[model samples]
Structures are given as structure tokens and as C-alpha cells.
Target: MVDKDATAAVSRSEEGDFVKSTWEVTVTSPEGVRHFPVYRTILKVPPVVLRLVQGELHFESALEVLHRREPVASGVLAVGETLRCGDWELSLHDRSGKSRAVLECFTDPFYSRIWTLHEQVTRVGRPGKRENELEIDHPTMSREHAVLSWEERGPVLRSSGRTWVDGVAAAETVLADGALVQMGDLLFQFRLLSELVLARGGLCVTSLGSFQARVHGELVTEKAWRTQAVRWMLARLALEWGRPVAVERLLDEFWPEMPEDKSRNNFNYTISTLRQVLGGSEAILRATGSLQLSPSFLGSHDLVALQRTLRVEDWGAAVELYGEYLPGCYLDWAVAMRGSLEQQVLQGGLRLLERYEASECWPEVLELGGKLHAIDSTCQRTALGVLRAHLGRGNASEGVRFYERFREHLGVELAMEPSAELAALAEQARGG
Candidate 1:
């Protein structure tokens, strides 16, 4: 059930709410050290109708006309009141309401672009001086990499170069209605929007990797949040999603430096602004002396997802989802939460390393070991796992080199010597 008003708002823009996207944020720590979060942006590219070459005409004619920028008869896109764009003859109701296609190219949580699949065979590859293909400006992309063709079943992708569908290498794969395609270093999602049902009304908040809040698939832009206080309030509540925190507790966490009377006034105003930005009173609920995000409005939070993955010992998924908690935020609550989650991810990485070692999966062990080591180089277990992985792969010289680095790092950083076990492993590597 998409919000009609929100969808209407989205339809009016070509790039959706990204015109005023949140790009970067800076926050100072309590100790006065300023932190700048890496650049990221939220994009809500709208879907467009997918049209084929009109009847009895060769596809080349349509292609030539489209290249010439001549207006064709792309129909009204009905996802939001039947909006029309370009001349591709696309509409939500076109082809029995299955004519919409969305190609979303995402580099990270912060950067993304969306394009409609209009051509019969959409060429994808590195940009050329005069080539008319979907040119991906990535170092890893080849000159003529792949082709995406519109078929009766759906969008079919074919590639001989490096290509992956849903993370598995594939030369040719018939893309599902919503398939994740990775070419070179960029990721793209192909979706037949008309064939998919809209999400049930809820607030989907993303805080890890990037910050975005979507209501029933409609993005809540930063402009809508007129105050930083309001954004902070929402983030705090989202951290405790569905759980109530005493109003006093929130006041203490957010404004411990201010006087109670002034803080309370600010808190009340922040809450009002938050509810309005989220679009209704039901977004936040008040009862007794506590505040909570209404459970019905909470959906697919990244932090919650990471916690669940950790609980189930899904180390790989947990590691993939882990990012700087509340980037650019040094607020007290955010700091505490960041430390707690970082420790969890660090521990999970160690466990995952041990699993990889046990299975003699040297590559996975090395990859995961490097990540854990970056987090905490002093962790003996991680260093040992990495050393063993290097040795297991028959790279004894590499193992010895890593050991030398680790031994020196430990002595200089912690004024400690490597344990006897680690020394013995290095000796074994030396002998080999």
C-alpha cells in the first residue's frame, strides 16, 4: 500500500528526492575531535514503463528515432498517476501492467542511479569516445562487456566478461523480476516494477552503510527533516526500534549538558518535528512517560538485521552488514552503540576466521582474517589465524613476513612479546 501523496511527490522529479540528497555530515566528539563521515547519498529513482518496438516496425527504426531524440509514443506511467516521459511508449498498464522496468546502479549505500530498460538489447560496458551503449565508467569494466535484452519472460542478461547475478558468476542468466546484477565493480538491480507488489505501509530505516528513511518505498528526504535535533531523535528511537525509552532517559542521553527545563522544551519540540517529518502522529507513540516508534511503522532496519545475524552466528552476513554505526555521529548514545556493535562484529569475525581455518579454506580464512586484523591488530587469535592461513596456502615466506610485522606491531604498540605458540609458528614458517 504505497502512500498516494508520497508517490505523487516522487513522480514529479526525474531523480526522485536525490536533488537535495544528504551527501556528508560532520560531528564533533565530546573530546572536541571532529569526525567526517564518508560521502554517501540517498536516491529514490522512480520506475519507468518498458516499451518494445511498435508493431510491424524493425527495432532499428525505433532505436534510430530514440537516438535522434525524436519523441515517440511512450504511454503514461501509472505507478504515480500515469506520468509520461520520453517517447518509449511505456505505461504501468502497458503489456497488461507488466511493462515497467527499473535498472538501479548502486556503488554503495550512498551512491545510486536508476535507468529504465527501454531498448530491446541494452549494451553495457566501459564508456567509449562515441559509443552509444550504457557506458559504465569503472576501471574494471571492459570495452564491450554485456548485453541486457528484453524477452517475453523478463529481462535476460548475457555476458562473457566478469559478470555476476546475485553474487554468483554467470555467463547468461534470465533475470528474475528483481535480480541483482554485478558488472565490473558496480551493482545493478533489474526490476519489473509493475509485476511486484508494493510494500505494506511502514517506515524502513537504513542507518548502517548509509542513512535513509523510506515510508512505504517513498523516500523521506533530508529537507523534510528541517532540524538536526529532529534527525537525532529519530535515530535514537530507531536504535531502540519498537522499544520505549523513558522521556527522561532520552533527555539525559541527548541533552545531558542542558538544564532540565530547557532540555524538556527542546525534546518536546523535537518529537513534534520528528512525527511531522515521518508524516503522521502514528510514526511515534507516546504513552505514560516513555516514547517508542510504532511497531507497525518499523521495517527492515539494518542495525536490527545485523543483530539478528549475529544471534544466529551468521558471521559472513553479519560482517557484510557491519559499518560505522551512525557515521559522523559522536553523540553519547551513538558512541556507546557503536562500541557495542563493533565488539560484536569483531568477535563474529574471529569466530568466522576459526571456522575457515578448521575447514582448511585458506582463501576465506585469509580474507576474513585481514578484515579482523584491520579492526584489532593486537588480537592474538586473529593474527594466529592469518598466519596459519598463509602457511596453509603454502606461502611460508608470506607467513613469516606477516609474523615479523605482527611481532613488531605488538612489541611497539603494547610493549609485549608474541606468545610462544605464535613464535613457534613463525619458526615453522622460517624452516619451510
Candidate 2:
């Protein structure tokens, strides 16, 4: 039998905590206002509205806009409360009845970590030479957590009228199809294999070689542009993370010889073309801008930034920002990081590897394992790698040490491995 003791009405307001929009709060039940909930979002970039109940708050299902194979549901929301869902925290105020939420997006700490503000907007992609409205106040910036930026209050990001992070518009962004892709921390190339490469193309592939051949041909067939600009664009694509570009760089380096004037516009055209070419690729994020590819993009600066963040006890941000890169990169720095960062880095790095091995981050495995050996000589990379040549399988205790240098090092590995594994490996590595 349905009880007459409960009543719930939903209300929404664009104004956050500024004005409490009270709908008819009719207490018809003998229990008096037994149930009441409110929900809604003022922004439209990623259509989201949440449902709030009298006692508990949860993401209102009707507020979702992005359609995925598996839809991601927003988290629970309560009056004057914060809840983490994916990268954001949903909030509502009871007294003020304010309705607004924020996505606490995570990012790996960089050289300018003290400038959390810079890091926040760094992901927004660079601005053009012309005026950009993206610049805004960062009410979201939290100093206690060492957040850099203010709160990113910009028309470009659109917190009020519109926002991009929560919408299909962000997903609909037309990337160069073949340009490298970066979603959060995972960086890899996107290829057009069979047909599935482009949503419009409808192709998929099993063999990588065929896809590479097809995509490259289509991309290279650029018809209209000054040869220099086209060549420069290719240089940026061909070169990533300071990866080798002898193949294309050579062509671009000698482009002056390629009959020019067939194109119109000089400096302005080149600049505009460059902007269009790079698009949302975040090429400016490179360590620095140079005419040619800077060699420093090579290895593990992301690790450096992360290692420091862990030292400072910024675990939440560390995990959220560079969760994917942590396994391999953390091991190397964990040993060397000291003070608050060491313990935090060691634990978090191991936690990730314990869950994922196919992520196959070997540099850290080698570095941390080596550190262990230097301390006790009984440690092996058994947990991380195949114990194939487990020569140290028996006498783990007394072997000669191998690792020598690190960016920093307080001690070696055996001392660092977690208790259970340390004992087991020691018992086996030594004759215990």
C-alpha cells in the first residue's frame, strides 16, 4: 500500500545561492514535508541537470546530454554539498537553494605547479593572437590544495551561459583525424584503420600497417597553401614529444627550394595557416616554442612534475591528472622523492601497477627495482616483470648491487617494497 506520508516537488534556478526559488512546498502529509528535492543546471555546453531528494542528492538522469555507448551518470548532489563524479563535484545549497556544480579536473603538475591557475587553463588549448574571451576569474581555485589558477572564469570556457566539458560539442570538435590524441593523461596516435577511424568513414582495422598507409596518404594531399606553411604543419605533426622527424623535417628544412609564389599571403597567411593547422592539438604546450622541434620532449618530464606533487601529498590530483602515466614513471622517482612526497609516491605508484601490468611501464620498474637491490640486493623486479632469469630467485639477500644514480635517492629498494612482498622476495632471494 502506498503511504500518504511522503511528498516531493522539484525546482531549478540559474541563480546559484543568490536567490532561493521555492516552488509550492505543500506539507500535505501528516509527517510534514516528508519528501522534497530540487535539481537543474544553468549551463548548456554539456547538457546536465541533477535531481535532489529531501535527504540525499544524486545526479538527475534527465540532465544528461552526451550520448555514449555506456552513458556516464552524474553523482549525487545535496543542498550546500559537494560530490565527486568523474572529474567534477556537484553541489546545491539548502538554505540558499543555490544550484551549481564544478568539475575539479585533474592535471599532472608541471614546472609551473605553483601556478595552479596556469595548469588549469593549459588544458583549454592556447589562445589565438587575437582577443580570446577564455580568460576568467577562478572561483574554483583552492589554495589549501595548492591549486594554481583563479577558477578559469572565461567566456571561452563558458561556466554560466555554456560550458564545454559536459557536452557533445567537446566531443564533436573536429580533430585532424590523424593528429596525435590526448584525452586526460593518456597520449597516443589515432589512426584510420579499416573504416572506423573516422565516424563518418566507418572503417576498422586489425593490421596497423594498412591503416598508417591510408591515413598518411589522405593527410599529405593538402591542395592549397604556401609550401612553407604546409611543410611547417607537417613538421609539427611528424614531431611529437621531441620524437624523431628526420623523415619530414628534412623535407621542411629544405622547403625554400619548392617553387613558392603559387600561393597568396605571406606572414599573415603563414600565421593563420599555422593556427588552423595546429587547431586544438595543444602544440604550444611543448616545453618551449622554437622554429624546429625541441629535443627536450623526449622522456618523462611528466614524471618530474608528478614526482614532486606526490612529495607534497597531492595524491588526489596526482591520481586524477596522470593516473595512466604513474605506473612506469612513479617507480623511478618514488625512491628518490623524500619528505612527504616519497611515502606518497611509493604507495600510489605501487597501487597503480598492482592493478595494471599490461600498461607495461618498464622504466620505473627497472629504476625502483634497482634501488631495492642497492639497499638489500635481495629485491628483484619479479612482481613487475617475468621471473624468467630469476637467477636471484634463490639468494635474494647477498647479490651485488646494480643501480647507481637517480635524480634523487635517499635509500634502496628492499627497504621500500611493501611488507608482504618484501618478506617473500627476501625469503626466496636469500636462503631464508
Candidate 3:
């Protein structure tokens, strides 16, 4: 039996709009016990839970029931309890506890398994049978290996016997997102779900063009770093987001002219001021004698996102991320970083243009080529790409116009004539 009013309340919640909520659950099948993250809407009226496993969704039947004699609100499920709906049953656990987090294992024997960290201390080793939270039965693995526990700052992993982080032998280290953890022959990638959730909707630093930070899609002008010192500091930090930047290195790079003692004091003051501007001291952390911008405070950053898309071979998205890198900033470091990113964008754009040309995707090639030309007006390769894309589409007039503009740009900027290849392309377009 259930309370009709409570049931009606839950029904109303389901009928309303949807909001994102994350959950950790375990599903037992004939193969074994598997754990994963479940993203569900605020309303639980459908009595179904959606599980995301390696970016794929699995629809599993679920039920809403009273837990501890209290009505289970929409999007709210009790921790450490198993509920049955239809033929499927799942045990839910709270992942937002003070010390709770999740570790996703990607090695064989337990690939795609999500390990819930609930206790103050949990161990990772090659346990006999079903003994450990994470078990890897390999010849290279020791019986009792590493320990994972929560610290005030974040989660930390310490090797009890033999373990490695990113191919380096480490006794203890603070776990970072995408860190490769190796024990024996088994390797796993670590991601803090708490950090991921915190990063869902927050400040977004756009560094591809002019540097700016936005909160919830709105520009944060009040906290903008106006001074050169503060602006450079924030730029450097954003460039190395999710990693620590040493104080000595920052001082050497940004303020080498100042004396050591004075520079240190000034750096300290700048850090304090930055924290105040960010609206919280926790946004910047001073740990292990280095500074780290909290990943939780970052929603999206163009540079980081561009690198990710490039890694995945997503040319369209990579092209979209391509823009003027740190425009109008004349600092030496900014100039160097900008040049490096420009080269990367050019190479990526050329690759995409070649692919599109092969597929006869003239419109896409034109779009990408035009963007590349805008970024580097004197780039002959980009000009050729645009001209060819136009010609392929039979837009001879547009191709001639592009060639004329490119020729003019070359003459004005370099005081040189267009290359033979470019001149031939324009001649062919005019003849056509």
C-alpha cells in the first residue's frame, strides 16, 4: 500500500519539466555484478532508469517506492537500498557523500565497471574470488595493492605494494581526472564524478579569441582581470587548467624583473585578489607548493574543448573551435602560445579540407577554408583551398573574387606577387 497524496505528488513532479540528476547503481546479471552511472529526469513517473555505459544508454525498468517509511520524491532515490520494478532490480547508493566518489575500471575482466567509494578507506588489489571492491586477477598484480581514500582537498591514491601512475612508479598521489592508474598489467582511468557534476554548470573561460569568463552564459565583466599582471596570471592558469602551476615558475615567467622577495609577495597578493574576484577562495588551490585552478569551477573552455575534439577526429567541431588565439595580447608568452595554436588549427583545417574535397563536400570545404583564410589572410594554402572549393561548386565568379582579395592581401602584407600555383588557379577560374 502507498499514500495516494504522496503518489500524486510524485506524479505531478513527473508531469513537470525535466532536470538532470546523476545516480550510482549496481545491476546484477548472470555474468556478474556491474555498476554504472544513471542519469535520470527529476520526474520518476515512468518507473524506468536510464543507464549510461560508455556513452550508450540502457533502458532498465525501475520503481518508485517508500524508503525508511518516507515518500520517495521525484529524482530522489535512497542510498544502500535495492528496489525491484518489473523484472529488473537495481541497488542505489549515494555518491555525493562527504567522502564518496566513483572509479570507473576499464581493464579486461571488469571493463566498464563503476566502483563506488563509500567507506573512509577502500582498497584496490587482485582479490581472490569476490573480496575487493575492485578486483584484477593478473600475474603482475599483487594481492593487496593500492588504497584510495578521501582527503580534505579531494581523493588521494596511495600504493600499498606496487602501482604506477602514468607509467611512473608512485607511492602516493592526488588523483586527477583522466589519470592512468596501473597495477600489475591492469590499467584504469580515474575520473572524479563529484568534480564532473560540479563542472556541469559554472564559469566558462573562452580563450580561443579574446579572453573572457562567463557564468551561465552571461559575461562576468565585474570580475574581469584588467591589470596586465592579473590578466596574464589568469591566462596562464586557464592554459594549464586541471593541473598545478608552480609559484617559482610563475614568478620566473611573469615577473622576472622583480626581486625574489617582492615578487613572491606580489604573487601572493595577486592570488588573493584573484580568489576574491572569483567569489570564493576555494576556486584556486595552493597545495604542494603549487597553484591549481579548481576544475569544478570550469564548465567549458574553448582551448580545452578544441583539443578534445581534435583528439576524437571531429573535424567539424574542431573547425568551429578554431578562432583568433588570445587576440590583441602582445605579451611574449601569449604570442608564443597563440602561434602554436594557430599552427595546430591550420594543420587540422587543411586535413578537414582535404577530406571534404575528397567527399565532394564543397559547401563544408568553403566554410572551413573561409574561416582559415580569415585567421591567416596571407596563408596561400588556405586561399587555394577556398578557390578550389568555389571552383568545384561552379562558382567561378566567387572564386575569382577570392583570388583577387588574396592577391591584394599578399601584395600589401608581404610586398610580393601571388605564387605561380595561386595565379594559375585564378587564371583557370577566370577562363571557366
lDDT of 2 by residue, 1-432 (tens): 101111133332221111122211111233322112221111111123333333343343323322222345465433444333344333444423221212222122221111111122323322334332222223332112111132434212212222222212233232232333333331223222112112221111111011110121233224433454454343333223233233333333434355444222343355455444444223323211233222212112333444444543443334433422212222222223322343454455445433333454444444444433332233234332322123234323332121112201213533343345433543454453
lDDT of 2: 0.30
lDDT for every model?
0.64, 0.30, 0.64
Q: Please give the distance, in angstroms, between residue 291's alpha carbon in candidate 2 and its true position after superposition.
A: 15
Model 3, span 227-343: residue lDDT tens: 667766777888876466778888888778999999998898788777766777857756446776664565567787676555545555666777777887777778998888778
Ranking of predictions according to lDDT = 3, 1, 2
- Across 244-344, the per-residue lDDT of candidate 1 in tens digits comes to 67898999988999999999999989998888888889777675588877654655678877775666456776787788788877788888888898899
Best prediction by TM-score = 3
RMSD (Cα, Å) of candidate 2?
A: 18.4
lDDT of 1 at 431: 97
- List TM-scores for all candidates, in order: 0.51, 0.23, 0.61
